[model samples]
Target: MPNPSSAVSRRTLVTAIGATAAAIATAPAAHAAAPSTTAAPSTPAPAAPGTQAARTVTVPATRARSAAGRAAAGVRTDFPIQYVGVSWDGPRRGGAIRLHHEETGPGSWQPIATGCAGGPDVAGTAAKAAPVSAALVPAGGAVGYDLRLPDGATNLRSTALDTTTGPARTTTLSPTTPVTFCGVEYLSRAAWGADESKRFKNGVENSPAKYYPLQTLTVHHTDTPNADPDPAATVRAIYEYHAITNDWGDIGYHFLIDEAGRIYEGRWSGDDGIPGHDANGNAVTAFHTAGFNSGNLGVALLGTLVNQEPTAKARRSLALVLALAARTHGLDPQAHVTFVNPVNGVTKPVDLISGHRDWLATDCPGGIMYGTLPALRAEVAAL
Candidate 1:
């Protein structure tokens, strides 16, 4: 009624002031609720200790089967089954077969009749025997066994049945197939003496003639498994290695034995009946042992013993080799061989079957193979 314009202006001013107050209040509240642009306080969960994750694994079937089979057979499952040799009694009619056992630790030889089958010779029987296993025979070791036939027999024929392959191995024996070792026909001195000169002379050419009075017969394992397992080839390779790699004239050892227990002539040819010499003023000594190379006759067996054992034929050949060496050296075959440790110069009375490690710092024959030395020597004594 007094002035409408003035009244409206006053009202608008009151409304504007109210709106400004409200905006100020809301801005403070929003600022308090929002996080600051600066770094926020860390709240990390505790970390786990440094550790590897768990894993699952599977074993091979052969190993598992062997373990189960051994457990059921009452034999220790941990040790590998090594076929040492087969034993058989011979007769004109037939023979009984048995397989000789060699356990992993130091133990006496045990016989297992489960794996063997009747065969012409122990090898044929062993080849056909169940389990279908094989072993490396160190030089001068036996690789087979002979069982006497029952009375009233003229000839024997037998075989081995391999359990793994289910195959039969058979051999027929005759008078013409004479027992041989190292590829050289094994004949009595009387029978083969006439060819000694030719054979002995041939041995000399295998290496330069180096002579030393044979004082010791040292045993060794080749450490390498022969791929071909041939005694002749094995000897040849050894000679070449010595001549080429070692810069020696020929194979250091005088003799070598294959898995079959067959012996092969090395540096000193069995034909020549002479010993070898080295470039270092040592006799053409066998290089079986590292430090004891000068006065020792090294006989290397062509196989490793990590998971395998020496064959029975190899064992027999080893015994025969030792016998020959002992006879040649004039050492008592029944007495222990003297081994002088090259490191400490400590002397030990090793059996006539001393090992390469017995005289050197290195493990020449390996643990399992060397472990059987005592038994080997005893067997040699009996032989």
Candidate 2:
């Protein structure tokens, strides 16, 4: 077992995985290291360093992108950053928020291909005094960032995450590669640096884990940067944003696949070794879709797929997981099925394997990835 608290690097999680379908409840604890501590900054710093613990920094909320799409106003951090997400004190809006990042050194700026729009403005979560951010944009190994917020997008702020800190994950990381539990390259929460303690506050769970009978398997793209350098840290940053900032108590998806095709376990499904289901195989309700959470299994690819195609490794893990879920849940991936909110009893027709945009008014999972949903469905069905 790798330490639960030690950091996980993209290198450790990268492995060649062509998996077979198996129920998560019966899966193995494929990898882990004992918990290790790193003093992460809770606030922003003024200059760049060789490395730093993973953390988020607030940046100027509004700026205009140049006609050439150059990053307008920006901020510098003391650590190498991996991803950036935009948030505002207002409702989510339309308009491209182009971004640029300085890789390690000043003047080496590059544009992030996927200009972000954040996530769907969900019900109930809209009234929080907290800023509502859309999707994330890639900023690989960047030490500085710049952005363009949509016009009239008030109180704009950027959530820039420096996930490329920490030492290179060594052999201490269990398996040091993907582990096959039946058929997928699964990374347990322990495989990443998830602070299980974050799931609780004042010794009580923020929201008790809830499960319902499985219905549909929905695929999503996190709208983060691609070619990630430290996916495990990225996962941790997302966990922080979702569990702490978003008050969701956990990351929203059931699973997360890195570009290397490793399927990171998401949403703290249970103690029975299952990633997203109860013993009876009921799906755990997560925060991905607003009105249709219950019974829908949400799996997010860990990057902005709309701008670039997911690597072949990511695509394989995605198909394997979807195939595994469909097999475990008795779903027909290629057919149109009725999706009923197990909590609200509201029903809608959906493909057996659908995209985030299919159920919400957002460009999630990206255009490039979304277009492959049909092919993904067939692949899942074939599996």
TM-score of each: 0.42, 0.68
Writing each residue's lDDT as its tens digit, candidate 2 over 1-383 gives: 11112222222212111133333334322232222232322443443566433333221111111111232246566555555654544445543433344533444434333222222123443212233444455556566665555556565545556543544322222332333444545766755656677789899998677777677788888777677665777777777667664557888888988887767889887776556766545667788877777777888988787767888767877887777666555457787888766555566688868887778667787999989888878866765
Q: What is the lDDT of residue 90 in candidate 1?
A: 28
lDDT per prediction? 0.39, 0.60
> lDDT winner among the candidates?
2
Candidate 1 deviates by what RMSD?
A: 38.8
lDDT of 1 by residue, 1-383 (tens): 01101112223323432343333332221100100111222333344686423221111111111112112222222323222222222222233323333422333333232211111111111112211221111221112222333355332222211111212222222122222322223322111111122222335632335344445666777665544433333343343334432334444566666666555555543332222323222234444444444445677777766456677667667766665455434455556555543322434465555776665444557677788887777765554
Model 1: lDDT equals: 0.39
The C-alpha stretches of model 2 lying farther than 4 A from their native spots are 1-81, 89-133, 138-160, 166-180
Q: Give one clash count per candidate, in the order shown.
A: 44, 23
RMSD of each: 38.8, 11.7
